[model samples]
Target: MSIKQRDANKNLEQTKSHLQSNHAIHHQAKKNLVQQPVTRFALFLLGTAATILGIYAIARHFSWWQLPYTSIAVIPTEAAQASLPPNINTNFVTAVVDRVGPAVVRIDAAKTVTNRLPDAFNDPFFRDFFGSQVPQPGRRTIRGAGSGFIISPNGRILTNAHVVDGADTVKVRLKDGRSFEGKVLGADPVTDVAVVQIQAQQLPTVKFGNSQQLQPGQWAIAIGNPLGLDNTVTTGIVSATGRSSSDVGIPDKRVNFIQTDAAINPGNSGGPLLNQQGEVIGMNTAIIGGAQGLGFAIPIHTAQRIADQLVARGRVEHAFLGIQMLTLTPEVKQQIASDPNSWLNVDEDRGVLVVRVVPDSPAAKAGLRVGDVIHKLNGQSVTEADAIRQAVENSAIGKDIRLELRRQGRTLNLAVRPGAFPTAQVE
Candidate 1:
């Protein structure tokens, strides 16, 4: 009875174990099937995300798309650059010309000059021989052309004084082909600045920049009518600044010219010299004869200052001392002392030497002698003759100027009142 019971129990237990093993395998297979769908979905999502990121990278590298208010990080690849348009080149120079080209104008002046007969032709015997055939004094019209720029909307223009000096009529022509009759308000020969007014309104005017802030190597653009060419554009850099009048071989003019390499021709005078920002920094005035790349301009500040006075009073009052002076360098001093016929004696190697004093002039009345060596004027050292002239030009009429002089091994301080420059001298 025990052997039969043991065998039956063992078989039943083995059957139960086999059934349990099959159930466990089926449950694991179902679990794996369920997890496989979720894993495949996660992999699909990752692949889709990677594809989207790759497309965005390519588009951004090629600048194919852009977002609002966003800056693109350019890759600078050749393929990317090849896609850009060729006409997209706009630089600072073109921008300046487009902004400032309208204000530049052309000025034409006509003056009547009278021709005089020679003294021999006017002789009694010569006149009697050809009484009817003798050429009589006649008048002829002289015409000149130059450049100018409008400073005010009402057609107030600024040009070189020499352009309109003694002109019987002035004609101003704008870039848009509009012409106007110009009236010369005044012309100052000392500074070579003149103001012309026309009866027009709402004209384009130039924007003025501070010349005091100008430096070497800064961009200089000139817009003017050069050699009868209207609206000519030239570009160069400021070569130098603060060139004295004597340094430029124009001692009669009281201007500290701005030197530039910009091509300024005969008709370029009174044209605006512009900076990079299209603001006027100077007025083109002169060019060295037979020289390449050498041009001079009046600082806009000085021109404006003189122009203001001329506009207000129709004239400028420059102070004068009425003395011909020479800067006493070593060579000049030696020449003066070595001369046997000259009565003047110069003992100093430096200072301004007065060679002649006009009778009854400010220098004569101030007791300034011919041999006087002016060491200082108005508390400033004087080493160049231009310095004294500049000081006199800046001095107010009837204002006292302190002069430090060295005469005969003695230092003398004298206060002299400056007088108005004679109109005869300015002509």
Candidate 2:
């Protein structure tokens, strides 16, 4: 009975184990069958994506489609163009420089300087011992440079009076590199205007514009040898016009200045101030210290008139009253009375006091006294001393000028004919 039972159990166990192995194999085969279709689909998708990326890269590398070019005309309107930088129209400046730069010149003035040698060097024994080694009276050249512009084809140049003043010789260098020896035709310190004559014919001339028509906020350009920089250009707007000489701190000069914000330095004194049309409107003159964007120029009309007078006769003759005067104010009157040494003692505080009347002059001939205060000139109120001088200068030479004076607290009207102003005795 035991042997039969054991043999049956072992056979049953073998059969169960065989069935479990077959079931395990069938499960693995079913998993492989299910995963095969998904693997193939994933590989196909990856290959298609790679192929599409390669095609795109090739198309981009070969410039398949290029961006369209844009023209300025296509900007549509001014409002759209307003988004652009302001200096885009710099071509106008470049063109103006090209047009007028050739006429601009650099003036180098050289003066003869003589220096005396020391006593030791001047000794006869030292001179005998050291022949050429001993120092003698040495003559050295002192040179100064300024700016100017040609005004005529026959080589008439315009510049400031201070530029070539006291210069023994003047050398002009044009922008095109031509050099010429210039002769000072005339120099008027009253207006600070000078005329130079060169020998060249067919010289380029700058076009002159009416400075009276110039308005503030108009474009102004200054081209000059500022600090010896040739043709250095600066741009700004016209700040003002008809600026009095007193306003510019140069009461001695009779200029009605054109004020601009364009940079004006030491060497820019005689350079021409050009308008937006590339025409000379003024002559660059003075700049105030401790101030930025404050530059003054002499009006071209005044300069032109002076230049005309100079060209006609090597000199300008202004009407002369021959009197030193001061604008009498309350403070000035009190200061004059308080100072015992003061000669200008006036009773009135609201008139121009005659400080001194030159001997044998028009004012002296008109019976103007030191204590007399001028109230009016030709019916115009004389609040400033320059007003009388300006009126006298504006009147024709030899014409009778009427002056109202307060002498000893009494108003007196006097008439006198003006005479030619001595150029040497001018401001």
TM-score winner among the candidates?
1
TM per prediction: 0.78, 0.71
Q: Write candidate 1's Cα lDDT for 1-427 as tens digits.
A: 6999999999999999999999999999888875898877987899999999999988877764454466453233343244345655445666677767888999999999999888999899999999899998999999999999999999999999999999999999999999999999999988899999999999999999999878889889999988899999998999998888878888778888899998889999989999877789999998878999989999999999999999999999989888888888999878877899888777889989988898889888999998889998888888988788878877899999999999899999999898988877631
- Model 2, range 1-427, lDDT digits (tens) per residue? 6999999999999999999999999999878875898877887899999999999998877763464666463122343234336656534566667778889999999898899777888778888999987766878988888999999999999999999988999999999898999999999988899999999999889999999899999889999999899999998989998787878998677777999999999889899999867889999989998899999999899899999999899889888888887888999999998998986547897988887778999878889888888887888887987677667767888999888989987889999898988866643
Error of 2 at 150 (Å): 1.2
Off by over 4 Å in 1: 1-88, 335-343
Flag clash pairs in model 2: none
Candidate 2 accuracy as TM-score: 0.71
Runs in model 2 deviating more than 4 A are 1-92, 115-138, 288-291, 337-344
Q: What local lDDT score does residue 342 receive in model 2, on the 0 to 100 scale?
A: 80
Residue-pair clashes, model 2: 0
